[model samples]
Target chain A: MLKRTPLFEKHVAAGARMVEFGGWEMPVQYSGIIDEHNAVRQSVGLFDISHMGRLMVRGPQAEEFLQHVVTCDVSAIPLGQSNYGLLCRPDGGIVDDIFIYHLPDEFLVVINASNREKDWQWLHDHTEGFDVEIVSRSDRWAMLAVQGPGAEALLIQAEESGAGSLHDLPFHGVALSSIFGYTALVARTGYTGEDGFELFFDAVHAEEIWDKLVGLGAKPCGLGARDSLRFEPCLALYGHEINDDINPYEARLGWVVKLDKGDFVGREALVAIKAAGPSRRLTGFEMVGKGVARGDYPVHTLDGEPIGVVTTGMPAPSIGRPLGIAYVPTSLSAEGSEFDILIREKPVRARAIKMPFYKPRYKK
Target chain B: MSHNVPAELRYSKSDEWVRVEGDELVIGITDFAQDQLGDIVYLELPKVGQVIAPGEPFGVIESVKASSDLYAPVGGEVVAVNGDLDASQEAINTAPYGAGWLIRVRPSGDEEEGIMDAAGYAAFCEDRAH
Candidate 1:
């Protein structure tokens, strides 16, 4: 049986094309992916991201435990700040990528929905000697992502009914707010690379908040648009781009790994890999011809020798061109390097390019 | 749903449809499928004269949103392939049941199986909608 979110009825009423995503029956699109993607790019869109996992770690040892578990230094983070980090296995493989937010009394970690159970168990198993309590808040809360250029304006209107004004929140910041007469945790963070707010509220109040946002001109978006939008921004998806078999260095996420912060789960492996260097590196590519490069497509040299494989690919709606990310040998991973994508046993020319095929227009 | 599903064509559960044209069976994705996929941007059509087995992937169609495999509805030898999709790929999104026809194949002497008639295809879509 598939799990259902609080907004399941809302999605049905909106004519959403439903798909089973990570054990939850969620909308893949409503009006359409392109339409919803464009809506979030130009205006505002609301997404039922309650499927994403949320965990709270609270105690006198909260900051100290997080500093030891995650690769990033959570000790220096002031209250209301959030930092992107990764949980790595002992051998440097990524367990899961997460965002750690520092609240006054506790640290909140938002992780991928698919990895929620695994991550929760991993955290518990590793916390045997620690004094912190690792609690899963996913079932108790519902999340709504309000994203786009006009997100703040729409959120302000929704927050008028006791929801706090979102005006003071900055990027990567979190605050307590009220909406629809319910207290909620409002964070100015998003995966779409757009200025937006992710609201964590009581699961029962999700429908009312969803309707209110829709009534305020926030188009209801789905996983389809969410994928395209995040793809355009080069944000990494766990299963597609990063996984347990791949480490942070190979995924080009070395910035999120802090080896100097002392021993962590994967510190030794990351340190050795950092010293010797990664054999294969993840890089971006653009199809020079008229074909779409998809995942698992062979990356080959001009002479037809296999080099690597594409990890993620799509026709970017924001750029109006075909783009993808691939894992290529270090020698050929440089920007402007030329390669070919083997499509149907035929070589299609592709050029290695810098990531973030689309630059976001964040509010100043 | 003004989109038309011609009575002469046969459709597979995967949304591919086949119609007899001269000595070959012409195949394309259904109009309903195109409408759901939205804005066909690129097509990976199979090469001419390739042998394809039933339910095997012959090509892929990628839109701005997702990628879907184009499967062979019946085992056959590819006699012809759609080359026009290389340039004006929107033909699939605009007229999927017609100009978007993906390939033509000579049957491997087997009777058509697992195909739905026009009325059956419409009902199949209706069943999926619920």
Candidate 2:
């Protein structure tokens, strides 16, 4: 059986093409992927991301426990701020990539929908000695992401419908706010590389909030648009780009690993890998030919020798070109290096390029 | 939702439509399949003159979301291919049952026994719907 979110009926009414995504029956799109993707890129779109996991950790040992578990330093972040990080196994393999938000005495961790159960269990198993309360709040909240260039204006319009104006909210910041008479947590964060806000509210009130956002000119987007939008920005999806077999260093997420913090789950392995350097590195590529390079597609060197595999790829909605990310050998991971992507058993030429295939227009 | 399956056209379980042209069987994905796939970006087709077996993958259709294989509706020799897909792949989404005709095959014999008609395809789709 597939799980349904609070907005399942809303999706059905909107004529959404639903699919089973990570155990939850969710909308892949309503109108279309390109249409919804362009809507989010040029205007505003709302996404029901309530399937993602949310957990709250509190107590005197919350900070200590988090710092010892995640790759990013949790002690430095001030209240209302959020930082992206990764939770790793003892051998430096990534358990899950997540975002940690500091809120007063508690810390909230947002994780991928597919990795929720695994992450929750890992956290529990590792918290044997920590003086903190590890509570999973996945079911209590519903998340709506308003993303695009005009995201702020649409969100403000929705806010005026019930919630107060949020004009002073800083980027990557979080605050308690209200929408449609319901108290919600409003965070200025998103995966689409656009200026947006993620609103977390009671699950029961999700439909009302979603309808209000849609009525305010925010198109209801789905996982299809979400994937294209994030792909354009080179945003990593947990399963596609990173997994238990790959470590942070190989995934080019070493920047989040703070070895100086000491004794994290994967500290020793990360330290050794950092010293030895990564053998293979994640790099971005643009198809120079006609075909779209997708996940598991073989990436070959100039002489047609296979070097790596594409982790994610798609025709970028923003740039209107085929782009993908792959884990290539360190020697060939540099920008401007050319490679061949095997599409339909034929080698299509592609070049390694810098990330954020399309530049974001975020307000600094 | 339309239930407007035209009676003249033949359909496959995979949502492909067939129109008999002389001895050739012209094949194209149905409107329902294109609608489900959203915008079609690339269509990888089998080479002309290649022999295909029924239910065998002869090509792939890539959309913005994912790639799905295009199966041969009937066993035959590929007589013609849609070369226009190389440039205007979006035609599949716009006119799937018409200009998007992927391939034409000369069947080895008259073997339309397992294929579904338009009404049957509609029922098939309805049965598969969530």
Candidate 3:
């Protein structure tokens, strides 16, 4: 049986098309993908991201335990801030990409929904010596993301409903505030290229907050729009971009791997991989041909020899063109490098382009 | 939950609709198909003179989220292609039965053999939806 988020009923009531995603029955689209996607780019949009896994770790060695597990420097993030990082196997292959939020006495790690059980097991297996407690709090909160250019303005309207002013929260900043008479955690972070905030509150209040936000003109976007919105920004999706066999470096996420952060899982292997240089690099490309390239579509040399496969491919709504990401030989990963994407047994022309496919407007 | 199923058109199990104008058959996907596909961005159809076998795929339609094959309801020779869809595939979404017509085909005389009429197709769609 698939799991359903707290807002599942609301989505159904709003006539959203539900699909199975990450083992959860989630809304894939409400209005439509293109309209909802463009709404986030031009105005503001709302999303239900409650299916993500939220795990809490707290103890004297909370920071120490995370340092050993994550690829980034956990100690560098000051209290009330979050940092993007990765968890990798000892072979340097990615386990999961995550967001770590630093609190006063505890650290909250947010992981992909599909990797919730795997990550929890991986974290537990590596915690034989650490004195920290890790607990899954997935059902405790329903997470909502209000993103795009007018996100702040839409959120501020809820101030009369007991929500605190979000005018001062910097990007990647977190704070405990109240929303609709319930205490919640509001963070200035988003997955889209637009400026926005993510709110985590009790599950029971999902409908109230969602309806209130929608009433304020925040378009109710779904997972369909979310995928397109993130695609243009080149935000990595777990199964598509990074996987247990694809290392962070080859996925073009090497910047998040802090090699200087001392001893950590995958650190040694990553050091060796870095010295050897990545054999293949992930790159953004636009279809010079007529068809839209899709995931697992083969990328080939002009002469028809297969080199790599598309990781994420779609018609980028914001870019107003068909674009995608793929792993190609490091020599062919440069901008303007021409290649072909095999769509339905025919190779379509494409050219490597600079990422992100769309420029971001993240607030400082 | 109701779809616009015109009472005069013929339908295929794959959700394509065919309109007979004498020996010529004009075909396009149903409103339900376009609704399910969501935001049609691209359409690829057979050439004007190409032959299509019954139940065979003649083209592909892609939305932002999915790609589906356009299946032929009956064996026919293509007469006309909706060239306007090359520039604006959204026509398939907004005007599915009219401007969104995909191809015109001269049927092989068995176009009505296995296809369903408006009422039967509507029932099929209703059954599948449930």
* Clash totals, every prediction: 1, 0, 0
lDDT of 3 by residue, B1-130 (tens): 7899999999998889999888899999999999999999878899999999888889999999988899999889999999998888999999999999999999986553569999998899899887
On residues A231-283, what C-alpha lDDT tens digit does candidate 1 reach at each position? 88888899878999998988989999888877888999999999999998998
Tens digit of lDDT per residue, candidate 1, span B1-130?
4457889998999999989877788889998889878778777777887998888888888887667888888878988888888788888877887788888899985534668899999888887766
Report the C-alpha displacement of residue B23, candidate 2, in angstroms. Answer: 6.6
* DockQ per model, Cα: 0.59, 0.70, 0.85
- Please write out the lDDT profile of model 3 over residues A10-98, one tens digit for every residue: 99999999999999999999999999998999999999999999999998899999999999999999999999999999999999999
Standalone chain B TM-score for every prediction: 0.93, 0.91, 0.95
TM-score of each: 0.87, 0.91, 0.97
Q: What is the Cα-based lDDT of residue B7 in candidate 3?
A: 93
Chain A fold similarity by TM-score, each prediction: 0.97, 0.96, 0.98
lDDT of 2 by residue, A79-154 (tens): 9988899999999999999999899889999999999899989998888788989888889888889998888877
| Quality of model 2 by C-alpha lDDT | 0.87
Fraction of real interface contacts that model 3 preserves: 0.78
Q: What TM-score does candidate 1 reach?
A: 0.87
lDDT at A99 for candidate 3? 95
- Off-target runs (Cα >4 Å) in candidate 3 are A160-164, B110-113
